[model samples]
Target: MTTTARRGRPRGEGTDARILEAAHELLLERGYDGYSIDEVAQRAGVAKTTLYRRWPTKDHLIVAVVAKIQDDVPVTDTGNIRHDLVTYLEAIVAGLDRMRRVGRGREPGDRSAGLVAEIVAAAARHPDVGQAVRAVFARRNALPLALLESARARGDLNPDARPDVIFDELAGAVYYRLLITGEPFGGDYASRLVDQVLAGARTPSPRAERS
Candidate 1:
């Protein structure tokens, strides 16, 4: 007689969404340290085991929330690198600004990184969390990277324009302001950033072109 292979029970529909929604709300209401997996389970109306089965650790769950935020932004290619880059960067700025407000009671124009700072610190403190955070960024950046590649191929960007370097310039400025200088990532900054980056990366006119 042959034994039948055992199969795990399927997850209940909407359980993950409920958990994520609860976690996101709690994260915004309370800072990262103030929230707990048990609180998430209680708010989500799901068992702690259910939450763990999906997210092995609290850091893992937090990374998942951050990933969701990243996934919500759209990256488009309209055959115009400047417009596309500006639009994409503006979306990223919006996400960062939103995350910056989470669990903070600062006045308007505050430049605090808030939960984003906690995320970075968590990643640094835990190797697995660092890998998870890096993976999230790597996956999220693929679209913008592809958009740059398309622009380069279409002659819209300079032949020497490196997408990774260009991305570093664009994203680094935002993070620098958020995490270091505490400068306001105000409106129009995205436009200015795109203009500067594209100006350096655009093909020069024949009159100004060097051999």
Candidate 2:
């Protein structure tokens, strides 16, 4: 059988996959500002109408790609909040490490960072992207929340401690170090964050400290 004839059996399946793949690659390459639907269609080797039939708009297509790449944060009941938090943060740091690899060798102020920032900004304006991003964070936090709750129940966390605020602080530190400060993301940094949070959560009473 000919190549076209053999593969033609799937009909629109191949075209749809191509469109999605093309959109993903172009979005990462050109970002929101530089990407266009027509360009995507051309890259995918499909008609403009075919691309539109699958995704009405570029925003919709980007959202779909983001959803497809969204990953579940792993949860582990390691019996120690510090260990669990460290593990969770390490997973996040690993993701950033991957991004750094992807962004390497690119020009200064290039599309890699610009693309991520644009997508985040766009998510603020687009309800579909916002919802999808929200869902991703929600799922990501499940394990951390469980670890926090377990710590509180075990009297490890401060009685007035707020897990949401704590998690945000921890994440903020890591993000600042990785994205802003250009500091290395490593096990030591993760361990330090866990220690910092734990120190803050320690009971302030001298007696509690002695115990």
Candidate 3:
């Protein structure tokens, strides 16, 4: 299907950008429950019918905003896997921190990070949302996965190392620390995370040392 057919806007047009920007700003200010789609349309200076024609629902708009946020982070192969991964993690952490400062309306302390936590819950509850979430991640994850694979091929990582597992570990650690443990990541967190993941598994096996 064509891009226009799917979303009612040509992929490069600025209407989508304006809508997302408005939605993101409002979300940070008022959180998930505080704003409505009509407010977003009004803020963007677009008609409500036009916005609905594209997003169809508020949840879809949320996904689009998140997608834009993820898409803004640049991914380049600088040949230094550690540096690249650290840069990416740092950006992700900074972005998430911005989103997490305000919780949902009722719970001031909600660790779910507002929009992200909402989408995660929505994805779990509704299969369609889950599909959309999967699509978003799949697009976002491709680059990092490729970076890991390149590092492995270049001998920067173990020959036996699985990029997917390592990717999960790195991302999982960050999310777990933020959402589950509520621990704050310091300025050096990205460097520390990269060093630990790379150094711990690049060569030695603890079992081998013991045996």
Candidate 4:
């Protein structure tokens, strides 16, 4: 069927898909701070009431857009703990690469950094925005959880250490470097981080001690 005909088919799967597509595009284009329900409705060619019926607030719409892009990071069983850790950190680096591209055309660190700052500011003002940000963080932590579990199973983690603690120790360092220090987070950084985490997590082998 023609695209116009399909969009005109009334309330169904296609309409919902179109609305979500519009929201996604707008979110990326304008960021959370500048997005508007009326613009989204116009872009989707749907009524403002329809958009409101689905998402009561901009926070809800932002969360829904994030949900659509959510993907599970694959946990690899590479036998070598260092390798698995590098792989996990590299996945995050890859995501940042895409975000960088999306934030292009603006001044240095203007697009992505500005958008993140705006989201944080919005969260401070709106409880619902804060909740949505928390939800996004929780959803994004799934992959890190898998990596931690795998390390624990392999006896690479200290017996007394909690998974959340380990995750914070590792992932939090990368985040601090990325968001705060604005350092280069390439493959070399990933390797170094893996080495650091492994040093802290792995028990020294008796053979290595003897050597």
Best by TM-score: 1
Which candidate would rank higher by TM-score, 1 or 4? Answer: 1
The candidate that wins on lDDT is 1
Error of 3 at 19 (Å): 2.3
The residue ranges of model 2 lying beyond 4 angstroms of the native Cα positions read 1-22, 37-57, 64-72, 107-115, 125-127, 205-211
Give one digit per residue, the lDDT tens place, for model 2 in 85-178: 8888887777665554453266543323333455676688778777876776677677688789888888888877888888888888876765
Residue pairs whose backbone atoms clash in candidate 1: none
Q: Which stretches of candidate 4 lie over 4 Å from their true place?
A: 1-31, 44-50, 75-80, 107-114, 204-211
Per-residue lDDT value at 82 in model 2: 84
Mark the regions of model 1 whose C-alpha exceeds 4 Å error after superposition: 1-18, 21-35, 203-211
lDDT of 4 by residue, 70-166 (tens): 4534557666667877877777666554554454355654424333444556677789888887788787777667767777787877665567876
Q: Write the per-residue lDDT of candidate 3 for residues 68-99, one digit (tens) a residue.
A: 77887778899999989999999888877767
lDDT of each: 0.81, 0.71, 0.79, 0.67
Residue-level lDDT tens digits of model 1 in 35-119:
7899999999977877887787788898887798788888888887788888888988888888777554767777778777877
Residue 56, candidate 4: Cα error in Å is 3.0
* lDDT at 154, model 4: 70
Window of ten residues with lowest summed lDDT in model 2: 108-117
Cα RMSD, model 1: 5.3
